[model samples]
Target: MRLLVIMSLFALSLVAARPDASKYPSRYDTVDLDMIVNNKKVLESYLKCVLDEGKCTPEGKELKAHIKEALETYCAKCTEPQKEGTRFVIGHLVKNEKEWWRKLSDKYDPERKYVTKYEAELKSIS
Candidate 1:
């Protein structure tokens, strides 16, 4: 009984230790953020999808599925590359695409909790 209890605790610890990171597939990590961000039409489509104003491609759907949790957890599950990509994209939006960023923040970060955490670095980028 004691061994079973110990084993259960260990299993639970492993599950709890790794959260959102495991849930998101690394396949998208190779996606070309530069291509998307540099192309206005492409960016707009993704924005529209995320904002629920348009259709979602498979990748967009995958992003939308995890966006909420990613924000809430401050991307706790994100790998290093994922975190870097987020910073780059968000910096671009916050600096170059204020209106869209505002809409996104309003939708996913209405309280500004996540924004507040990275405000300094994001602002300093440019």
Candidate 2:
């Protein structure tokens, strides 16, 4: 009976030590854009545009569109491996922006002029 209890306790402990398979993957795999972009001129241009937009703009839609275009253009000009690398960077940027917007709610809006400036910067990078 003592051995049986010990075995049962050990089984329970093992179960407790194991993580839930359902939560196997979490947000930890989420990428970081700053790390991916590093000191790349194109990424610098994109970030500059995003910052110049002032984070208070109705022009975010237009600026986002332009940024996507610039990313595509940059990818087009890159070699195959470079294109893959840039894609990874851009993916992280997109993911980060989405997460930021979701977390900030409506607090981060910018003016049209700011957004236009951002769009222009993206265009310049392209």
Candidate 3:
């Protein structure tokens, strides 16, 4: 009986730690991804912000706050448009900004685990 209770507690802990597919904040979802991607300086600034090499704007800070979790959950909490925007931004980076992408991977995916976990949905855009 004690063993059963311990197992049940462990299971519950695992479930609790797992992020659910709830909505992330919608405020920044409206940010102009096209402008960011097209403007080399703007995109580099965001990369530096995430890598902790430069100052972060409010949006950059928000992005930094959520990046690890978003990667861990494959953006499970992102809204539909947020997911699409993620694909758009990432596709642009992989295609055009290999060096920045490498820096981002080193910081956020140091274990080399989560960056490539994009699966087919992100692949379709790339």
Residue-level lDDT of model 3, residues 81-104, one tens digit each, is: 566677667666656776766666
Best by TM-score: 1
* Candidate 1 lDDT tens digits, 30-110: 556667778889777777777788896666665666666666666665555566666667666766777877777777779
Candidate 1 regions exceeding 4 Å error are 1-23, 124-126
TM accuracy, model 2: 0.26
Taken over the whole model, the C-alpha lDDT of each candidate is 0.55, 0.27, 0.54
Which candidate order results from sorting by lDDT in descending order? 1, 3, 2
Q: Candidate 2: give the clashing pairs.
A: 55-109, 56-109, 56-110, 57-109, 57-110, 57-111
Ranking by TM-score: 1, 3, 2
**Number of the candidate with higher TM-score, 2 or 3:** 3
Candidate 3: global Cα-lDDT?
0.54
lDDT of 2: 0.27
lDDT of 2 by residue, 1-126 (tens): 000000000000111111444211112122233442454553433343343433412222223323333332332322233333333443333334443322222222233222233234435665
What TM-score should be assigned to candidate 1?
0.78
Error of 1 at 63 (Å): 0.6
